[model samples]
Target chain A: MLELFQGPLFISILAAMVRIATPLLFSAMGELVTQRAGIWNISVEGTMLLGAVVAYVIASSTGSPWLALLVAVLACALLSLILSFVTIVLKSEQFIAGLALNLLASGLTLFWFQTYIIGRDPPKFAGFEAVEIPYLSDIPVLGTVLFSQRVLTYVSFLLPLAVWFFLYRTRYGLEVRCVGENPKALDVKGLSVGGRQCLAIMFGSVMSGFGGAFLMLGYSDRFVPDLIAGRGWLVVVAIIAGNWMPFRVVGAIFIFALLEAIGIHAQVVGVSIPHHVFLVLPYVASLVLLAGLRSRTHQPVALGIPYRRE
Target chain B: MAKAFSSLIVGAFGSQKALLGSLAKATPLLLVGLGTVIAFRAKIWNIGQEGQVLAGAMCAYWASLWIGPLPYLIAVAVLVLAGLAGGGVLGLLAGVLKTRFGTSEIISTVMLNYIVIFLLAYLLDGGPWMESGATVAYHQSPPVNAMLEWPTLFGQGAAKLHFGFILALGATALSALLLERTPLGYEIRAFGSNPTALRFRGTDISRLLLVVMLVSGALAGLAGAGELFGTSHRLRAETLLGIGSSGIVVAMVGGLRPSGAMLAALFFGALKSGAIYMRLQSGTPAGLVSAMEGLVLLFFLCAAVATRVHITVRSEAHA
Candidate 1:
């Protein structure tokens, strides 16, 4: 075990962990903002799927990763806008509508990916590259693990801080939180609840889309149907685990990534646990974390309820 | 009534084999859908129906492999039992977590799905569940004993329709009985509508969630058995992909009604089976009908949302 923690493999695992955490960070930030505006936005997975497909298509077609990423973010924003239209403006059951959107995203992406690519996996272009600062890459163990990765990895780290600033330190942020906590009070204050929620959904979509783009561009480098693979839901879990705070969300992502990393390591090393025990690790961990946090944390009073002005 | 009748006639018996194929495919979805309805009614979101289905299929396949020379009736019973146990245990774990830890059923069930997929993948790839020395690029276990399979209703040469259809119908009836005729069902409905109220009344929402999840999972598990015994007769990794999400669709479309689930499941089964047939017939790209499936869901969501909007407006007007 000491040997396992002492060297390059440790650095590799840390780097991989950050990469894994990037999507969750994007999604958690998105979810936090949405919740802050009083919407659950369960369509995070569907939006991310759409973003991945659109990003992969754009990048593969134009061979411009940056342009591809922009398009993906826009696609997710559009998806959020639609969700906002139905749930916020139309006053729908956010949960059911979100689930339907997710199903639609999955079906549509699978259909197109299957159609265009036939049987082969979707094509990939050069994805976003990692940046090395002049002196940062030379630091010892921490340097290799933390400083070395794709741009999205660093962006993921920066995003939480950005989210924290926007959420707690800004006027718009305060308004959003107020709206979430008590929409009627905010309505009395003359803030448009629907407008704020729609904005939050858009903000969340940007992060989710970035996360989706990262899945194809940064992690796997090719789009597969069902590419997000429950990461969207995991992001929601991270939001709750982090107590809806941006920085704390990283810890939740770390716990999940760590569980997954350990499971992969065990399998790679051929450790003889009953295969089912190892298979169920992350889910068990998530359940435990969720249970532990349930009592201690305070969720927004209006988290999943749709808001309409009387 | 007349419109529904026309659609039903066209949908069910537009052709000879169409009705049979539709029913055959509907069996698994109907079972899974009814189970989902049970959980949904209890406010326990058990989305791992596909995993339960796969687990049931694997258990049944495994049972048939080992329980050789047993009477056909006994073998079939063991297969169904094994499926129920495997799925029930998985559901029980989810239920416990939801009850004890306050974890969201949605997240737990989704993650459990991945675990099931990768676990099955591992089994077929090289682990204990693999059939040995397979030449096919894909990994799958051997077919179950032919004698253990369900018999066809119409004729020997009829397409793959079998007793699983009847089993699914029976499950639907049981689901209705469970929800409507029993005190337990009353508690499930009450708990689902208001868990906090149930807690105040000392009804134990956690226990209810757990029981409902287990029962739901067991039903989904039996669906897997039906799929195996009725048609494919083998457990393949290919079956798990879309079935779970489709169950959600069925549950929603049914308005969480047990009989409605049976109907919705039949519709989806036909959609799926017919989509393939239409694809093969039309030479429309294989993905076209899938795209239609996605489009239909999207429209369905829009309609639901629109309805909500109308209700809110009406209530506001009255208020």
Candidate 2:
């Protein structure tokens, strides 16, 4: 067991944790903002998947990661708009609408991939590559673990801080929070609750899009079916476990990523424990964390309800 | 494009064999949709039907192993009951968590879906229940005992339909009867319409939730059993997972009614059957059918909301 904590192994595990946490951080931060505004966008899973496919297709065809990321964000934002229209404009049930979007995304991605790319070797392009910070790379233990990452990973690390500031320090942030807690107040004050919630959903979806892009470009070489792999759900779980706080959401994401990284390392090192146990550790951990911490977390009062002008 | 469309129709229902195939595919959706209707009517939000189905399938498969030595009729009954219990317990856990700890059923159910799926994967992936000769690539349980299999209805060789279709129809009838005639059904509808009023009248909301979840989960589990005994003859992930989500679409498209779900399931099943045929004959991707299902659900949801809510257009002069 002591060998597990050796210099190289420890640093590598920490590095893997950081890498794995990047996408979750992006989506979780996004979800935190959306939830703060009182809309439960359950379509995060679907949006991430759509984003991954859009990014992969564009990147492979154009050979430009930046363009791919931009298109992916737009694609996911479009999906969020649909979700907003149904839930906010039509006043439909948020949960079912989100599930429908997920099914649509999954089916569309698989259909497009099969129709366009199947029966042939699809083109492959090197996605975003890791870059080391000039001065920080020389730091001992922390250097390789934190300083060397894809540009997306660096952005992900700073996102929670930015979200925290937006939520607490800005006047617009106060309106977003109020929209969730009491939309009637916002309506009486001549602010459009639906408009604010719409923007929040769009912002959250764009972040999820970036998360999906990072997953495909930084972690994987190709876009596979269901490539998001429930990371979107994990983002929702992280926000819940964190009590919807941006920094706390980061902590929750890191914990899940740590477990996932350890699970992968355990498989590589040929640990004697049952592989299934390791495989299921992160999911089980989320369940436990949710059941334990959810009681303490206060949800937005009108989180899932459709707000209307009275 | 017109030729391809005609062929798709021909592939789905042009022949007796295609019609039977569509019926077979619709059976599980109908059963699971009935289950979803019950829960949704009660405002339970049991979205973990996918996991419940897996749990039921695993349990039914396990039960079949021991019951094979008994009388065929008795064995089948035991297997069915076991499947129901397996799914019911999972649903009950979520319900209990919601009532006891104030957990959101939606989140818990969704999380349970993943947990149960992983558990199924663990069991099938060279675990104790895996077929002895199965390789790593093909994770599945051993074929269920022949006596435990649902008897086919028609077509001796390649076009065999199973008794599961009848079972699904019976479940639909039973659900409609229970929801419309019985006191429990009346109470369920009442709870959905006004839980506060029901609670005020001394009806136990938590207990009602538990019962609703159990019935809902049991129906989904029975669907899983039908798939195992009627169609696949073995426990596999691919056969089980898609039905749960599709069942939701069926339930919603049916307007959360049993009869409506039955009709919706038939339509979706026809599309699925036709898509398979379309893929084989005309090279259309089967995933398109799945997307169509999503589209139908989305449209129906929008319609459901639109009919109920009054959309007032604002004048630019007011601004």
Candidate 3:
């Protein structure tokens, strides 16, 4: 246990924790914005999968990580638009459609991967580079803990603040909240509720896609099947656990990441505890957190239900 | 439906070997779909059926691997019980979360599915169940004793049709009876169709939930056994992982009725078996069945919602 806390090991775990938390951060932020606009885009997982696979394919082909990231975000945004067309325009169920989209993404990606992208073993390309802060790099523990990280990780850390500012300080953000709370009232006021939801979902899709990109290029540096690995679902839990607040959501993501780190660390150090028992910690914690949050008063009034003008 | 049948028949039974393979592939989906039907009738959104099936397979395989020299009948019973226990426990966990804390079972069960997959991966790679020896390549748990393997009722060689297919049929029959002819069946139907009635009658929602979830999980656990004792005879990483998704498609298509689930399961099972044949015959890419499953689900949900919307529109126009 003490050996696990050595400088390099501790730093590596912290880095891994940050890496894991980045995608959750991006996804939760996207989900928060979507809910604020009255659309529950539960297809975050699907969008992330699309992003990861597309990004990996592009990166492998062109050897340009930035271009790969661009394609990933754009492709997933298009997928999100398709989802919005079905749910927002056709009045489909959000949860059911979201689940279908996830299945479609998983199936299509795997089919292509098997058919086309076989020989590359680890799905290789140049991964994201760490961005080291100039002055902060020498600051004892804080330097290793925070300043030395990937560019995506830094963006992930700053995203909650940006999202918080957008939601709380912008007129459009207020409009989104109004639409979520009472789409009928928004329609009465001649505001396009459907339009706002469409925009929100697209925005959420891009962020989720970026989150997927982070998984491939920033952390794992390789694309395995289902590589997003329930991080999207974990982000959904973080959204609830944080009571839908941006900062609180980050805290929730961190808690889960810390639990994951502990589990991984416990195994790495060859601890005597049954590793599977430790593996169950994050899920059980999610269950407990979800249970404890039953009384929270911040749920969107019209979440998961379709809306149309009367 | 007829067009689908004609295509399905041509695709599945077009050749002698094709007929056998389809039956082999359909067994797991049939078991999973039957389990899904029970839970859906109780209005329990059990998305963990896949995970439950995985857990069931693991436990059944574990039992077979460890409990040696036991009588064959006792071993089989223990294997089935192990699956039931595994699935029931997971379902009961979902139930507790639902009743005691008001957590959404749909989300919880879905999350549990991922957790189980990860747990299985870990188990196969360096965990307790890991096969001893070289660590460079993938390692797996030891296969079950050959004596413990389920017998094929028909066909030889590649056309093996095991007893699990019969088990699936018996499960569907038993589920139909339990759901249509008992007091508990009435309660399940009542709860799903209208939960307000159960609340009004002072029936403990928590207790009802426990029973429903246990039954749901147990049946799914049997699906795991079907894969293990019936086919693979060993627990592997991907075993029974996606059956939950297929089960959901089946349940939705069947409208949550037991008889409907049986038909839907057969439909899906045939689709899957046919899809494999489709891959072999047409050189169609694999994972097409997955997309087709999604398409079927999308069509079903759209149909349900459209009908509901039409009714609302008509009623509102009348008002």
The most accurate candidate by lDDT is 2
Give every collision pair in model 2. none
True contacts kept of 1: 0.51
| Positional deviation of residue B194's Cα in model 3 after best superposition, in angstroms | 3.4
Count of residue pairs whose backbone atoms collide, per candidate: 2, 0, 0
Error of 1 at A143 (Å): 2.7
For B134-191, candidate 1 gives per-residue lDDT tens digits of 7663667667678888777753443567877788888889889989999889998988
Candidate 2 chain B, poorest ten consecutive residues by summed lDDT: B309-318
Docking quality tier of model 2 = medium
Which predicted model would earn the best TM-score?
Answer: 2
TM-score of each: 0.91, 0.96, 0.90
The TM-score obtained by model 3 is: 0.90
Q: Which portions of model 1 miss their true places by more than 4 Å? A: A1-3, A120-124, A259-281, A308-310, B1-14, B155-158, B196-202, B285-294, B305-319
lDDT of 2 by residue, A79-182 (tens): 89888899889888888888999999999988998999888898896699899999997899888999998889999999888998998899999999999999
Model 3 lDDT tens row, B1-319: 3444455566777776767767777777777777788887776777788788888887787777778788777877788788788888888888888888888887799777767777887787777777777566364566778888777788765567888788788888888888899878888888888899888998777888889888888888878887777776667766566787887778778887767877787777767777665666565665767877877777777788788889989999999
User: Candidate 2, after superposition: displacement of residue A189 in Å?
Assistant: 1.4
Clashing pairs in model 3, backbone N/Cα/C closer than 3 A: none
